[model samples]
Structure formats: C-alpha cells, structure tokens
Target: MRPLSTATLLCMSLIVPSLSQAEPRPANMVYLRTVDPTIEQDIRYATAHNFTGHPLDGYEAPQCLLSLDAAQALARVQASLKAQGYGLKVFDCYRPARAVADMGRFATQPGDPRKAEFYPRVDKQDFWHLGYVAKVSNHSRGNTVDLTLIGPQGLPADTWSPAASQADCAAPYGQRWHDGAVDMGTGFDCFDERAHTDSQAITATAQQNRERLTEALKKEGFVGYSKEWWHFTYAGDGAQKAVMDFPITAP
Candidate 1:
C-alpha cells in the first residue's frame, strides 16, 4: 500500500480524536418509552419535585432510560397490569452515578426545603443509614427503578409547585399529597418505616396494593427492596453490573 500523503494523515488525526472523544450511549441501553409508550413516567429527579429539592446532576431530561433487558421486563409487567385495569408509573430509572453523588451531598447539606413531603420524620443525615438513599445505587447499572401503581380509583395527581401545601408523606392516603397513584402506605421517597414493603402499620387496602405491585414485578424477575416499597431491581439475564454515568438527555 502507498504511504498516506501529509494532508490525508492530518485529516485522519482529527477524525480519530473526534471519534475517541465521543461517548455515545451503549447499544444495550434504551429509553423506556421506546420500549413501551403506554407505561407512564414521572421522572422526579429530572425536575425539582423530589427529596433533594433540586434536579440532580446528569439529569438533563425527564426520561426513563434503562437496560434493554430491564425495560423489556417492565413492559411485560405493564402489559399484565393493563388487563386488570391498572398501569405502571415510574418515578425514576437509570440514575447516573453523578446523581448518586449529588444525593450523598444533599444528605449532608443544611437545606431540606422539600423535607415535609418527602422525609418528614427522618433527618436528612440519616438517609443513608435508614436505607432510603444509597451511596452506590443499583439504578446506575440501569436495571433498577422506582415506581408505583395507578388504578381507576386513584385520585387525580395535583400539579406540584413551590407554593403547594406540604403534607407529611406518612399521612393517610386521602390527606397526603396525591401522586395519582394508589396508596402504598406512604408516598414515594418517604424515609420512614411506613414505606417498608411488608410494614403492617398501613391500612389493609394499602397492604393489598403493595402486594399486587410486588407480585406483578416479581413475576418478571424484579426483586423489591424491603426498605422501600417503590424500589425494585431487575435480576434477570442481561442485567447490567457496571455503573453508568451517561447524562439523561432529550431524544
């Protein structure tokens, strides 16, 4: 083969660096909406409607990205629930590693503007010890998700604003902030024992709702976290193990 000319070699150098600098999303990861548009998504971290009172790092868009395997499994769960006049709604999925670090920083910080509605009874510093937040989250691996069940009887979710009234997360279903989801003992991200998956402190109706959601997800190889009723991690084949830090972006 002939030796490359000077201009050809220069052009090759520029192309090589550009390609090397690119950090395209892995082929195995995908947005959940593409997998199942019917499933509802209310990605809280993408907005300031979460425990942190601010959007975490790497969440540029409110989209549910997950491992293809986990997304497929969740879609199956959504399908099964639809037959029973129910649907799945996700709060978070595929959290970036930087977001996890942001959570850690939030726990140590002084501000807790949203504490009344998210973690009313727990101290922000105790979030890690109480198992409400993790230093290394499985969500970064793209197989875990925080979700809730929506049914015909659920009250309409009120639009949250900075001026909205703050209600304790553990308050009775009707008295608390209505997230348009069935009562599961406590609201999402409630750092209290009432949010425990098998806690008996809740009403029978709430217990039944938790069980229904748990069983539906379990059938698809997703395992629930005992501490947080809304948290589940997919443990089936093709589940990702390495943590990912890709920024959540608008498609």
Candidate 2:
C-alpha cells in the first residue's frame, strides 16, 4: 500500500473519531421512580420550566434518571424527610453531557424570556465565569442532583407571578417567581451569591429550610455545592465514573 500524505491523514483524523477518544457508555442507570416512588420530581430540563425556557437536548422525557448508587442514596434521604412531613422534590438528575453543551450554547444566545426569573442580575455571558454554567458538570456522571423539599400538602407554596419584582438570586423568597418548590432563599438554578448554600442573607425561615435539606442529604453521603443550595453530588465511585450522554427516555 502507498503511504498516505500527512494532509490526507489529518483530514481523516478530523472526519473519524478514534475509538480511544470515544466516551464509554455507562450501565445500570435507573429512573428515580423505580427505586422510590415517594420522591417528587420536576425534571425541569426535560420541560419548558427551566432556565432555558425550553426543553434541553438529551432530555426526551421528564424523568429523574440517576446512577443506581445515587438514586439509592436519594431514596434514603427521602425516607428521612418523609417522617418529618416533608418529601424530596428533584429538579434535575443524571444530566447528559450533550445537555451540558446545550446549556453553554443557550447562554451564548440573546433574548432569554425567563432571564428575569432565573438570572435577572447576572448576564448570560458571565455564566461560565460566575460558575452558573459549566462545560463539564458532575450531573453527567449520573451522581449529581438538583432538588428541594416539598411540604406536607405535597404542593409548593410559591407565590408565583410573572410580574413579580425582579431581585438578585440572593433576594428573599417572595421576591422571585413562586417556584413551587419550598422557599430555599431563591428559585431553582438561581444564579447568584444569594443562592449560595450557606448564604446568611436569606430569612430565618428560608435558612432553616435550606439547612434541613442539607442535613438530610448529608446523612446519605451526598455533598451540597456551596454556590447552589439545590445542587448535590454523590461522593463515591459514581462521581469518578465517565460522563454519560444517554437521553432521559421513559422506561
């Protein structure tokens, strides 16, 4: 065979991905409902209810898919909360790597309809620098989750209004959209320092609710992100696993 020219080799390399460069497909992921039906789920990225104001890529259904280990840990957290007239309501879990890329793409675009509710204070271009959006998220590993607590009525006591006054993510509860989730200082995916897990700027009631959630997840081996009260990562082998690109299809 004749030796291929360097230019030809480079072109071929660009056209075909090497097997070594391909990410590994993970096994044993499960929908959260399979392990614990009591846990409530919003799965925001799968619906138009998220920061993007549109369904994200790779989320085919509104489902809380997660690594088995992470799901089980979440189940334990649910059990603990249930006894106290509270239940877990997850916003996101087991995000696909493609979805992370989608988030980055959306941030670059102009005209976000939901910006007032999710990121009113921070500009979209600053998302990466502010850690509001990431190129690589722990969620792709199927071990991270964004969640909150639901009250005994199984309803969010949100005081939602499109005309609600706009405030920074750190603004106290009623100032933002009445996101049905329990008042955790800010709305889900609220991109602000006020959303910081340990922020002392929130009301005493909101602070208590935030601590309650953190303590519940902590007992199950999950660690809350300092910047987002709703974000948690399972600290185990799952966190070290390869990021996934599987869609959240219905079982």
Candidate 3:
C-alpha cells in the first residue's frame, strides 16, 4: 500500500543501471521474490481452485520495459510468506513486451493447427477476442505475477497421476487424484469454462480444492480472476504503467 521507501528507492536506482541485455534466464531466474498480500491470497485461492503446478523461481523482463518499484513490491510479498511458513512459488514473471509482441510468431490465431502442439485446448481463436493472453500484458509492468501455493512442507501434494495428462478442472477429483503442479482444480493457462475460478460444472471435490486456495489467498489480499482461476496479479495501489518489451533472460 505504501510507496517504495527512500532507502529501497536508492538501492533500486543502483541495481537497475548495472544490468545489461542478455539471454533468457536459465529457465530458473525468471522467478523473483517479493511481498504482497495479493500473491499469498492468490496462492491460497489456487489451493482451493485445485492448482497443482509448482511455483517458478524467477522472472523475465520485458525487452525494454522495466519496473523496479514493481519488483520490490514482489520481494516484499515473498518476505511476508517466509514469515508464515510459506514461500512464494512463481510460474512466469516480468514477461518481456517483445515476447508479447512476438505473439504473431505463433499462429495469428491460438487455434492454428500448426501450433496445436503448443496450445492443446481452445485454439488460436481466443488470443485476441477471448482474452487468453494479449500482446501487451500488465506483467510487462513488472507488477503482475503467475504463481500458486505450497503446503506446510513447502511442497504441495503430488497433483499429478498417470491420468493427470488427461485430467481437466471439471473432472471428478474423487475419481482421480489432482493433476498438474498447481493446486488449482485445473492446469495453468487451461482454456476452459471449467477452469473458471469457481464453476459449478466442476465436481464437488474439485470445487473444495479451489475453495482451499481462495480462502488462503483472501487472507493475503490477492484476488482471483473469474476467467482463469490460476491467474492472479499483485495489483496494489500502484499506478498502471506502460507495457515493456524486455524478454526474460538470466546471467
């Protein structure tokens, strides 16, 4: 809620100037740590939603867009979780605007069979109209994050099963163990109505799983998105800024 302190601001100024253009982080550094009730809240909500994915450990900067303030905010949220027996597990962070811009590289439509190997559900059809994702993500602002909650062990139950590969959020949890690394009822970025944060169409067990995540996230401040139950952004009182094109890369 409060703006970056004078001390943090000075530190950020020093760090930002020293970084340089480089390749994507080793699929690891993409996740950064930060504190925001929103992120915790998001994780709790995910547990309820039935997220089974693991938290990512780093982030990617937009090709050209950067937000040091947002990065600090994220670190704050991570710190808060460490205080409560939880650690922030990230998925994707600081998406480079260039990556977003390069969306065209894929099928102009998300459903183009050419890319079906990449996106299994829905199709190239929803990218623009359906809002599966966009050319300009607020994540480029460094103010958004993609993550899920871990258990007391700092790890979640193995949501994957032999059947996990075919499981959908709406499937019966009793009939099958949770699938995917996230605690949410479905997989991350799963494009389906059942993936909605709260969908009656899902089995009772799946619904309960989602509720678990929601309750936890609410305690923190991260609110869930109605469309994609697994997606939540730590949008505090910060101003909405321009999108960046910095790609996620590591040293």
lDDT by residue for model 2 (133-216), tens: 999999998889999878743234444333443444455555555556667777788887888988888778788888899999
Question: lDDT per model, in order?
Answer: 0.92, 0.81, 0.48
Cα shift from native, residue 104, model 3 (Å): 4.5
TM-score winner among the candidates? 1
Question: What RMSD does each model have against the real structure?
Answer: 6.2, 5.3, 12.7
Q: Tell me the tens digit of each residue's lDDT in model 3 across 1-251.
A: 98999999999877775456434332212333222333332232112232212222222321211244444555555555557655445555566665455453443623332222123466665556777667567666665666555545322344433234344434443332332233455555566677777677765755665665555554545566787765556555553465555444432
Q: How close is candidate 1 to the true structure, as a TM-score?
A: 0.91
Return the TM-score for each candidate structure: 0.91, 0.83, 0.56
Which pairs clash (backbone N, Cα, C closer than 3 Å) in model 1? none
Candidates sorted on lDDT, descending: 1, 2, 3
User: Which residues of candidate 1, in runs, are more than 4 Å off?
Assistant: 1-23
Model 3 lDDT, full chain set: 0.48
Stretches of candidate 2 off by over 4 Å are 1-25, 153-172, 237-240
Best first by TM-score, ranked: 1, 2, 3
